[model samples]
Target chain A: MYLIITALAAAVATAFWYKNRLNDKLHLGALCLMYWGAALMWLVDCVAAIIAGEEEIIDTSLNAALLGICSVALGLAIWLILLLIRSRRNKSQATSINSH
Target chain B: MACFAAPLAEAVITTVLMKRFEKKEKMTDAPNESQAGIPWSRKLKWLNNLLWGGSALLALEHIWHGEIIPQFPFLTALKEPGGVLPMLGEIATVGVGMAAFVTLVWFFMIKIADARAKKAAVSGKTAETEPCI
Candidate 1:
């Protein structure tokens, strides 16, 4: 479920990036990369499950999902931290401009 | 079903809100050349926030359900009857629906922004550039 959701999100983000490639920014590209990375990780897990057979596929998939969720969460955290720093810098710039 | 629906719904709602806020920001922030052509960056930021917020909520939900134990092979809770199939089904339905919704909204936003730009051009406010994506 997490896999499908992130994959879908990644697809949408990628399309947006493609259409606006000339004007793309680092953070946006990072976001697309993050979701695509998560989706790819889950895809590997799915492949592993196929190799493991039915008896172990369930356990393997569950573990994979957990790891996928964790990775997504970590990616989000990093993005948010970056966003906050950017916003703060922008704020300070604006304040200096106004004071001048 | 609701379990999966929760994250999908959250993602959509957050994306909408973030997009709205970004639009407001663009309007107030003066049309700099650097920002003018990069409308998709705002959309990307919104989508990033949605994904991050949704993932965090889902993690908390999993923890509440006791699916995140410290033991090896954690998430044994998902091995219950019916397993992850139902959850996957719900995610598929909701994810597709939300994706379609966001796409439609994005298309409309571009359309409107283009129209407004054309109007500006006609009124001699600004020269018409390429349509924003």
Candidate 2:
């Protein structure tokens, strides 16, 4: 399920964020915010479906689970790309500071 | 079925607000979090990023389900005669709820950040000050 996958990503990001609180360079906090926001949205969706009797809570079919995994993978790939960009920016910033 | 549209709409409105704040920030200073109280635009940016990311994923999932299409009146639900009302109802309830919940969470984040900044200040690390000679 998208809910489980996204929530798991959020947990991992939250842990990393907690550990790296001293340094804001990684921007894991932002990553955590993104995933947690996703998880919350999915939660609301799941609840709404249940209340409406539209869908089951757990759709454990192979295709659905695979899709959820793919979505999470895509999300993480984007986060990694962002981290690389920020790190490069920070590096350039540090060089300018040193030159100054 | 078009529930994700709610947060996506919210994201558009927030993107506008964020751009306005960002322009103000640029006029004042760089987009630096090390600045006092962080920046309103930066704080708002957290919300914008979350909403945008979530909306993108939801939109993709919906598209995969063929609930959305790459044509006019993109939502398939809209194509059904007399489908407008039910789709609107879903958006009103689910979409609004998701947007409001995210906003509430953003408020909590702001509070936590403020508290952390205050603690750092108390520890003499948050601001630049001249030392006694």
Candidate 3:
């Protein structure tokens, strides 16, 4: 499950980077967010395993939910950021057009 | 039969819904304007429909087949209930996780599509708002 989450994270980050090549800043920022979420999931999974005293097997669902929450949060944040940027640009263009 | 059939049925439903959404998105982004047809909101509505349908399937499957709790020795000290509460909780958690994961994937798809559209919109410098606007 960790591998699944990692792979999904990688896929998402790659897609973001590829799609946003015109904006390297947004690409890196989104990638960092994904990686941070993945890293946090790994940390939580590892710590939970240690606390469980079950070194042989680790629970994947706990980490899965954590990662899911992180993904939703990051996705919403990205959507909001993009929307804000687009609206501001539109507003600025509208003002310029009006002035002209 | 809700155990095995439910998941497969849900998968079929999800596939149909996703394809419908894709079609809506395509039509919405087309150059030809046609507002008298299907509403544009259906593009995202189908995605939400998938999440709800998928969650229902996941919950039903988990309740019917999934284990209620972790196999921890300490937790096992508590008497297990033959009732439905344990299954409900487990299924609820799994369903929520599955739905959230799918929603995240849908968001990623939307972001990629939006980015591509934005790039296309800027490249030719031709205002193509007839369809989307």
Q: Identify the leading candidate in terms of TM-score.
A: 2
lDDT of model 3 at residue B86?
47
Which CAPRI category fits model 3? incorrect
lDDT of 1 at B111: 61
* TM-score of candidate 1's A chain against the true A chain: 0.60
2 against 3, candidate with superior DockQ: 2
Ranking 1 against 2 by TM-score, winner: 2
Reference-based lDDT, each prediction: 0.55, 0.78, 0.45
Candidate achieving higher TM-score, 1 or 3: 1
Q: Candidate 1: lDDT of B58?
A: 47
Residue B4's lDDT within candidate 3 is: 20
Those runs of model 3 whose alpha carbons end farther than 4 Å from true positions after fitting are: A1-100, B1-13, B19-83, B125-133
Best by lDDT: 2
Q: Clashes in model 3: which pairs?
A: none
iRMSD (1 decimal) for each model: 10.7, 8.1, 11.9
Query: Per-residue lDDT tens digits of candidate 1, residues B10-122?
Result: 55675677777677777776464333533554655544444444444445545645765667545543556775686565456544444444445445655665566556655
Q: Chain B vs. true chain B: TM-score for each candidate?
A: 0.44, 0.84, 0.42
Over the stretch A23-90, how does candidate 1's per-residue lDDT look in tens digits? Answer: 65445555665565445434444454565463543333565467545655666677678778988999
lDDT score, candidate 1, position B133 = 27
- TM-score ranking from best to worst? 2, 1, 3
